[model samples]
Target: MIVAFSVTPLGVGEEVGEYVADAVRVVRASGLANRTDAMFTTLEGEWDEVMDVVKRAVEAVEARSPRVSFILKADIRPGVTDGITSKVETVERHLAEG
Candidate 1:
């Protein structure tokens, strides 16, 4: 499964990069396949493990801010691995071929 999530700390004013970084740090340390774009951090792993990472990431953000807003989108497909890169690569291939 691949979970793409965003944790935004509310009531922390406009600048929340530090809190966001804390969440990303937790994801990076989890030893899972992951990627961070401008909007969301995508985590790839078993369902339980991925959810645990997401929970820890939310906790990281919560430590700094009074409230947090969490958003997540997941792709859950059994018998799939490396979907993170392979999915994108597949799109890129089609684009290149066109």
Candidate 2:
């Protein structure tokens, strides 16, 4: 199974694009593919791991800019899109297959 999320950030000034880019990189680094509009699809070992990754992703940004004034969130859920879910699921299958 896989958990996916929609990541949204607000009030980003100056380097808004850069900030967004960094966040995207973080998710991709986690082997998650971001769909569109801040949504990411990734695999987790379990439910807890999925949430933990989401938490870390949020913290990564918060830790960077305290004065962020930038509001952010990740909307995580399972089984939203058939393909996305399958895509994330592939990660788990591959891990086991390896």
Candidate 3:
């Protein structure tokens, strides 16, 4: 599964980058196949591991602020892996063929 999520602390004004970084750090430390883009951090793993990471990441941000906002999107295609990179690569390949 590929889970792309964005976590942010609410009521914290404009300075949420540090809190977001904390969440990203948790994801990185998990050593799962992951990617961090401007909007979302994508984690590739089984359902349990992926949800665990997301929960912990939310906790990291929640620690700083009383309220938090989180958004998640998941692609659960069984018998497949590396969708984080490979899915984008496949699209780019199709574009190149044009």
Candidate with top TM-score is 1
Look at candidate 1 and tell me the lDDT of residue 52.
98
Q: Write down the worst ten-residue block by lDDT for model 3.
A: 7-16
Ranking by lDDT: 1, 3, 2
Tens digits of per-residue lDDT for model 1, 32-90: 99999999999999999999999999999999899999999999999999999999999
Clashes of each: 0, 0, 0
Q: Write the per-residue lDDT of candidate 2 for residues 1-98, one digit (tens) a residue.
A: 35455444455556555555655566667654344354443444345655666666666666655443333333445555444556559999999998
Q: Which stretches of model 3 miss by more than 4 angstroms?
A: none
> Which residue segments of model 2 deviate by more than 4 Å?
1-15, 32-34, 38-45, 67-98
Error of 1 at 66 (Å): 0.5
Candidate maximizing lDDT: 1
Measured by TM-score, how close is model 1 to the native structure?
0.99
Q: Can you give the TM-score per candidate against the true fold?
A: 0.99, 0.46, 0.97
Per-residue lDDT over 18-94 for candidate 3, one digit per residue giving the tens place of the 0 to 100 score: 99999999999999999898999999999999999999999999998989989999999998988899999999999
In angstroms, the error of model 1 at 27 is: 0.2
* lDDT of the structure predicted as candidate 1: 0.97
Pitting candidate 2 against candidate 3, the one with the higher TM-score is: 3
TM-score of 2: 0.46
